[model samples]
Target chain A: MNFKEALESGKFTVTAEVGPPKGTDITEMLHHIDLLKGKIDAANVTDNQSAVMRINSLSVCKIAMDKGLEPILQMTCRDRNRIGLQSDLLGASILGVHNVLCMTGDHTSAGDHKEAKTVYDIESVQLLNVVNNLNSGKDMMGNELKGPTSFYQGAVVTPEANPVEPQLMKFEKKVNAGANFFQTQAIYDIDKFKGFMDFARKFDVKVLAGFVVLKSAGMANFLNKFVPGITVPQELIDELKEAGKEKALDAGMNICARQIKQLKDEKICDGVHIMAIGMEDKVPEIMERAGLL
Target chain B: MIITKKKDPNNILETVKKYDKFFLIGCSECASLCGTGNEEALQEMTDFLESNGKKVTGQLVPKTGCQTLGTKIELKKDKEACADADAVIVMSCGAGTQSATEIFKDKPVYPSNDSLFLGNMTRFQMFDERCSLCGECVIGKTAGICPLTNCPKGLLVGPCGGMSDGKCEVSPDVPCAWVRIYERQKSLDNLDEMKEVLEPKDWSAGQKPGNLSTRSEKKEEKK
Candidate 1:
């Protein structure tokens, strides 16, 4: 079944993130897609993840579709103006890629090309409205479209953001803007996530808890120090440190699988979105350990 | 007020290398307060120019450099010196620089300062932007805090995912605009307004080369 159908079925829907390569060589990316076949309800093609330039998400989404995998076309407002964004949405619709995840992307300064000009002509909430307009056979300006797109719209949230109230307000705005589902920033603390879910349950949209598989103790420390809105609990870091270098990867997978299991068992959220970063090959193993396979 | 910063001295010298004589103009308003275009700044530029083997014909720090016609009239006393100069250097904002361009149509006009933004002076010579002139104001709904001018991402509804510890991810020193708005609204017991999803901003209202004429409005009123 497609991602929309999977979500509506009330089953635990799983999605994985796949970043396009910087160059044209899609050999490893295709291999990763092949590995994830039938393993996930959908594969999210990141649009220049972290503002670093990469192969466009649209082409990769089309490629994923050709390989019989549902693709979630991630669109960001950092690089494209409103005109470019709307045109790309139309292009994605024509290519049979329906799922679009709206994001107010990481600023261009965070990327490799720090000198690049940013174009935040429209932000995530407005982008969601644009998607809803397109789905309704109209444009953002209220102009009619000859053909309409039926998009499965998605957006992102930060459950662990320090100032959680503003984030919650934006989350509700996204819901009002017609966001069907939300895949949040990587969440490490389950109890804190439970608190966020208690508030999120008021909305009709589905919430997909984000999980980034921890690779090592140092990685957890780095996440805590550098990555915003994500705080790695000290105990989890200690668990990884005790596992040592050789067994850390396994220990990390175990932690991720355990978290996923708890999230599923407690029904804290509708589903989980796994962001393996560069470790796509290990996703099936992680899912198997979580009893998802 | 419009905030401005001076161009590098070396870069300015290089730009005017081909010209032997220059007539400098300064603004006594914002540019003077910014230390980019004032009597002291103009004297410093004159010294720098003469030491670099260039000649300064004349200089003026007008009451308002952007008042094109008034500046043109004020510059009439230096017409001889201006006519002898090869180029005109403006040490003010872009508007002030364009005034020189209009007055000296035959000579090349150069700006020695870059107009940064419309902002307020938080302290002596320290400026912070507070408005973007988006042509539509939503500060009433946001508790008088303008997110469009403050937020780096200009997120309409609320903060983006990058807000951490009430600070913006882009710059840790800068507090998140939405967080400030939320706090202010909460204090005023107007948090309910925060829940209202603001419609998409009409960008056309702030479209490029924005033009207006108060005289036309007055004519319409008279009619």
Candidate 2:
């Protein structure tokens, strides 16, 4: 389905994400998917979350699909050159994984292999254009492909981005380059999210405000400090801080539900990506409180 | 502001499948300026290589590659350009060819383009690599202001508020970057100019040690 139709399904399309383990273990990963299968519309398999190499995102995504779930394949351009990138795009298509998100992978410095060489012949915007080209039966050099790709191309956004104009400019560029839909960084501040939506609405594209489930205020602070372009406000940190050890989990879920409700009630975005991280079980509860159930 | 361009060696020493007698040739013009194939450089390199054992030959060809074709630019093709030198290490930029390969395409070719984006030459032999284009440009939020450009003295952190009487606190000659930014922003019709504060940039990626460029939200790792 075109991303727009899937996004504006109006029933408030709920999606969840699962980051695979850095090691070769699938039991927890499978459990995560099994828990979210019928609870949400689709599950996204993150590619090497934060660029530290993990179990292949595509392989894990295929596993999720095998469990009778629609997996939004997240492909980053970090580890692949142009040849590998296109091959992977075709690889995803051949695997029947039609919903794919394109991203320029995390920097090598942030990953496990700090000294690894980076083959940067293609980055994200170019990656989006590359997929657009592939779908048009052409490669980066404008060479024709064997067949066209009908993959539903998606990109990302950071609502709380610093100097947000560049993000907006990139958002526009991605759309022009054929990004049909976008998933944003988690939203903790309503004003910031609204501002982002205001910017997004100006462009003709589908947006899913991404929700990264915070385990605690510490996690929020970590992202704000270390993670570039992602800032969870102090109020959310305070809310997390108020939750006692035993009840912290409960408070986190409550916060997630509250945010989800606001996102749905305000129609802040076309959809929301529930990134439960390792805690996939709480997703359904968050959804239930948000009234998606 | 390190402005320079690649100077591909003319006789690239391209694909020296096999070799022995090697002349470390040098170009006196662009290569010299770029600190690569100059006579002093080639001489030093040739001396070091000779000290290591192999028979050596060296020549300093000036204006060797001002044109695209032929040896017309060849000021003088001594024996070093022909016989003694097994392969021509055409120290000129990619434009430098034939002189080395004329006698030896069968030899190798190497590049000296050190290709770099052209930049304004600030001084006689020095240049400032202008417009770093940090991805996180505070230009918009800062009222069409560029803390980078306006500050003649190169300060990423905003100018000191205590700039003694409008001049840069850093120096007397340098105008406060903030003062310039304020003026530019005011003209841009953004009254909100100077209202928004600039965030200290994420020096992690932009830091030379990281070697990361200002990319979109998606940071590309060099594969």
Candidate 3:
């Protein structure tokens, strides 16, 4: 079943994201896709993830589709203006692509390309509206189209964003902008997530708790120190530290599995979006350990 | 105010080399403070041009360069000298340069300064960009700070994941704008106000060649 159908089925769905390689070499990426076939409801192909230059997300998604995997086209406003975004949406539809995750991507300065010009011609909320407009057979300028799209619109939210009110406000705006589902930023503190869910449940949208698989104590510490809207609790870091260098990856997977199990067991959200970063191969193990597979 | 910086003297000199006589206009407002089109700057240009074998017919620093009608009225006193000049050199921002262009359609207009942005003079001659003229304002929500101008990313809901040690990823010297806003909001105990993600700005409002009338002039208009 497609991601939209899977979301509506009320059964907890699993989605995984993949970052396209920087150069033309797709051997590793295609292998990753083969590994994830039938393992996830949908695979999100990231567009220039972290503002770093990579293979286009659309190209990667098409590759995934050719290999018989449902692809979620991650579209960001950082690199494209309205014209580019609308054209890609039309192209995605024509190619039989289904899901599209709209987001205001990481700034160019954050990535390897510090001198790149970032175009936020529209933010994530407005991008969602643009998708909705395209789906309705009209463009942002109210121009009609020869054929319309049926993209499953998705947006990202940060539950742990300090001054959570703005995040909540943007969440409401995204929902109002025709976002069908939300895949949030990496969430570690479950109770805080539950609090965010309490407010999120009021809207009629699917909420996917975002899990950034922890690889080691140092990684967790890095995220805690550097990444915003992500608070890796001390105990989880301590757990990874106790596991030490030899078994840290296993320990990290176990920690991710435990969070997934708890989120699933408690029915805290509609589903979980596993962002394994470069470690996409470990996602299935995380699922299996979580008793999901 | 609209900040401006003087163009390279050599470049301006090269443009006016074909013309023997030139008139100069400057603004006493933003241009004066920026040391671009002030009375002192105009006099310096006059001396420099005179030494370089060019006759400066007349020079005047108008009350406001962008107020086209007012500058025209003030320039009437220098009408004979202006009429003798082959070209008019404006020593203010782009807007003020364009004002001169509008006033003297018959003569070629040259700008001596490049307009930068709407800014505040933070200290003596030091300026800080405070707005992008995005046409829509959201400083009310961001503790009177403009993320569009201050944040390198222009992120409305930011302090993106790249922030480190309360500094922007782009430069360590530049403190993250969102971090400043958060700290300001926290100190003012107004953090709750920033919770709503500012909706995307109505970019059309900021479209190029923006024009609007506030209706405050309605009383005069009806007269």
Candidate 4:
């Protein structure tokens, strides 16, 4: 089923992400698409994910479509201006790429190209509005379009944000801006994620808990230090450390599966969006362990 | 009020080296408080220009440098000296510099101070940005603090996860604006309003070269 249909059907949908490579070689990317096609309900194609230059998310979405997998195109405001964004939305609609994930993305400094000029002409909230406007058959300037898009608009939220008030405030804005669903930042603490969902449930939008599998202890520490809004608790880090060098990956997968299973059992959210950066092959295992299969 | 900082003496000198005689305009408002266009500052600049072998034909510390009509009326007394000057140097903000440019269309008008921001003077000569003039005010919702000015990212809804130790992620010394707002709102027992998520800003309202008439110039379209 398509992402919107799956979300509306409320069967605990599963979504994953696929980051397009920096160069023209799509062999490994295609393999990833094939691996994730049937395992997850929909796969998101990231647009130069860490502000790094890569194959366009639209192009990767097209590849995923060719592989018979539904693709959610992740668009960032850090790179494109309003005009570029509008044109890309129209293009995506024409190409039959329906799902969109709007974000104010990682800053340009986090990417490979440090000196690139960042264009935040409009951030995530405004971008969501633009998508809503387009879906309504009207442009940002209030001009009517000959054809309107039927995009399943989505946005990102950080449940574990230190000052959670602002994030909650923005979450409401996203709902007001016509977000159909939310795929959150990587979630480690389920109770905090549930707290975020308590607020989210007030709105008529789906919330998908983000699950990034912890490969090792060092990876968890790195995310805690560098990634904003993401906190890998000391206990989880300690657990991974105790798992020993050889079994850390397996322990990490188990932790991810447990969180997904808890989220599913508790009905805390509509579903989970698995983000296995370079390890797409292991997603089916995660889904199976979580009893999603 | 508009905040401004004076340009470097060497840079101003280099810019006006070709002109020997000049008229200096200073503002008695924000620029004066900022110490860029006060009477003492004008006198100091005049002495420096004279010491550097340049002529200060006349100088006027106008009540408000940005009020073009009032400045034009005030400059009537110094018309002869202003006419004799090769250029005009405005020691106020960019708006004041543009006023000089508007008044003296022929003479090259230059700004001696760089316009910083519209801010609150926290103390004597210490200015802190309080508003970004986004053309829409949400202070009532944000507990009288502007996220646009205080937050480095200017996030309408934030304190992005990057914040740590109650400080902003972008700038360590800066307290997270949203955090400050939350505290204030909590103290005031107004946390209920915090639930209201601010919608996307109507950016067209703050379009560049913003112009408006406070009252009617033409009749209203509808009653």
Candidate 5:
């Protein structure tokens, strides 16, 4: 099903990501795509995540399409100006890779590459507006596009930003800019995500509460420290610490599953994007435990 | 007019270091873009300097640095900072730079940033220098990356092995110019679009180690 149809289906849809390596070997990607075949409504391909600059996400989308798995591609404005962004939209539409998640992306500073100059021709809100303009067969600079594109464009939100008001304001702007749906930053507290959802429901936009299966206590703490707009409760940290090394992975997965179950049961979001990161192999297992499959 | 901002505390402290009697000159025009002479920026600079070191004698006057028509009137208004002070720092662009230098030839007048270009802010805090009055723009073909301004090595076809993973080898903290070009290509999915490498740039246009300026009338007359 197309992303929007899947959204309208109201089945408590599930989504996950499978990052393609920098090189051409797709064995690991194949394995993960196969694993998620029937489990998720869609699988997202990260585009040079963390600004490391790797193999393109479009190629990975082609591989996922071959594997009979739907793909939601992540596009960042850090690299492309308005022209490239519009052309890529058309190209992705032609490939039937319909779902897209737009992000301003992690700055070059956060990635392994510190000195990369950023392309701010269009920031996130402007990017959202460009997508809207492109869908209508035009580019940002008033040039008409060669063809039109019809794709379900999605953007991200951080539910845990210290001042939730600004995130909400951007959310409103993004929705106005033609973001049909959104996937939030990872949600560790069900109540917080729900409070965000209550605020979200006031708008006419669809939302998917983001969930990342924590790998270890260290990983959880690291995210809280480095990742902006993401905060994990100390209780979850203590839970991971209690599990110890051998069982930590399983415990992290369980906590993630419980969070997903709560989101699904409470019907707070239209879907969920489980960012397994390096833990893609265990995503299906976690989803099954969460009763999503 | 030559201009500079007193944003850096050390510079402000130095400017006002020994001057117990001072005049903080502010320009009402052109220098507004740099915000050096804008009331808030100037007032803040004045307050910070006074609290940190020297006692600043009050006098902030907006100037018409380029137009000599009001030179007498402006001097009457702001001559206090120039005459009574040990040094005079004009907060204006090159016009303000030269004008201040000419007015207070014996005193101190500094040019900040060499008056790079007319720029606008990105997200307010982050500034992006856009126009370089070079009378030439390659944004159409280069996809707006501005190799002239952005590329350190000025390589047309980039990401030479020097790019150890996106970051440039020339400076580890800096991203290789070619890496940015490659990324722009990837995002547009136009990897196969542009013909291989572009010819080396003709540095002839701006290679000089001297001043550069443009006059709108020259182009208007040419047309």
Candidate 6:
């Protein structure tokens, strides 16, 4: 089933993220897609993820479609103005890529191109509204669309954000703006996630917990220190440390699979979205370990 | 007030290399407070120019450099010096530079300072941007904290996923605008307003080349 159908069917859906290469060599990307063809409900093609320029997400989405792997076209408001954003959405719709994950992307200064001019004309909530407007057979300005889109719109939330109220408020705004589902930032602490889920259960939308696989103890420490809205508990770090450098990757996979299993078994949310970063080859193994396959 | 920073002296020198003699203009308001257009700065620039083999014809610290007509009247005394100068260097914001440009139609006009943004001086010489002039104001709904200006992404609804420890991801030192708004609204017992999804901003309202007149409507009506 498609992502929307899968969500509506109340199945424990699984999705993954695939970052398009910086250069034109799509060899690794295609291989990743091939590895995840049937494993994920939909693969999200990142739009210049972390503000670093990459192959456009739309082209990769089309490639994923051609490869028979469903693609979620991740759209960020950082790089495009409303005009460009709306035009791209229409183009994506016509190109047969429906699912969109709207996000207010990382600031340009955070990326390799610090000198790049940012165009956050509209943010994530507004972008979700734009998608809703397109799906309703009209553009943002209330102009009629010649051919309307039918997109399964998604948005993101940071469940473990320190100041959770504001994030929650934005979450409700996204839902009100017609976000069908939400794939969150990397989630490590399940108990903390449970609290967020309790509040999210009131809404009609679906929530998919996010997991970014930890490669080592140092990686976990780095995430805890630098990355916002993500916290890797001390115990997980200890487990990786105990696993040592060579086996840390396997230990990280075990941690991710265990979290997924806990989230699924407890019905914390509808699904899970795994961001393997560059470890796409290990996703199927992680899934198999989680009893998803 | 409009915040500004002085351009590099070498870059400024390179820009006016063709001109040997130049007149200087500074603002007594925001630019002066920013130390980019004060009397000391003008004297410093004059000395730097003279040392670099360029002549300083004259200098003026206008009460308000952007008050183009007033500045024009004030420059009447310096007409001889201005006419003698090969160019005029404005040591103020872009608006002040344009004022000099208007007065010196034939002479080459250049800005010595880059106009940064409209901001308030939080401390002595410390400024923070408080408004983006988005035309439409949503601070009433946001408990007077302007997210459109403070938030790096200008997120209207609330903070983005990048907000952590009540700080914005753009910079750890910068507090998340929406968090401040949320807290303020909560303190006021007006958190219900936070739930209202703001409609998309009409960007055309703040479109470029914005022009406005606050003159009394009765004069136009009488005409």
lDDT for model 4 comes to: 0.88
Which portions of model 1 show Cα errors greater than 4 Å?
A: B216-223
Q: Give the CA lDDT, 0 to 100, for residue A271 in model 5.
A: 83
| Model 2 chain B worst lDDT run, 10 consecutive residues | B153-162
Instruction: Let me know the DockQ for model 5.
Output: 0.03
Clashing pairs in 4: A229-B161
TM-score of candidate 1 against the unseen true structure: 0.97
Any idea what lDDT model 6 has? Answer: 0.93
lDDT tens readout by residue for model 1, A1-293: 78999998888989998889999899999999999989989999999999999999999999999998899999999999988999999999999999999999999879999899888888998899999999999998889999999999999999999878888888988999999999999999999999999999999999999999999999999999889899999999999999999999999999999999999998899899999999999999999999999
Candidate 2 per-residue C-alpha lDDT over B1-223 given as tens digits, one digit per residue, 9 for 90 to 100: 2233433332233344255567555566656666665676677656654665545564655554534343434524564444666665555555454344553446564444453533456666565444555545666655555655554323333332223334543345655556566556557766354543333344344555333456765555443
Model 5, stretches more than 4 Å misplaced?
B1-223
TM-score of candidate 4 chain A against the true chain A:
0.98
Q: Score the docking of each candidate (DockQ).
A: 0.75, 0.04, 0.24, 0.26, 0.03, 0.82
Task: Summarize candidate 4's per-residue lDDT along A1-293 as a digit string, tens digits.
Answer: 67788899998999998989989998999999999997799999999988789999999999899888999999988788788999999999999999999987766767799788777667787889999899999988889999999899999888887767667777787898889999988999988877778888999999999989999999999998867688998999999999998999999999999999999998999999999999999999999999999
Against the hidden reference, what TM-scores do the models get? Answer: 0.97, 0.62, 0.78, 0.80, 0.61, 0.97
How would you order the candidates by lDDT, starting with the best?
A: 6, 1, 4, 3, 5, 2
Candidate 5 C-alpha RMSD relative to the actual structure: 14.7
- Displacement of residue A19 (Cα, Å) in model 4 is 2.8
Name the better of 4 and 6 by DockQ: 6
The DockQ of predicted model 6 stands at 0.82
Q: Model 1 over residues B96-151: C-alpha lDDT tens digits? A: 99989999999999999999999899999999999999999988888898988899
Better of 2 and 3 by lDDT: 3
> Distance (Å) between predicted and true CA of A270, model 5?
1.4
Would candidate 5 be rated incorrect, acceptable, medium or high by CAPRI criteria?
incorrect
CAPRI category for model 4: acceptable
lDDT of 1: 0.93
Q: Report the C-alpha displacement of residue A15, candidate 3, in angstroms.
A: 1.7
Fraction of native contacts, model 1: 0.82
Docking class of 3: acceptable
Give the winner by DockQ. 6
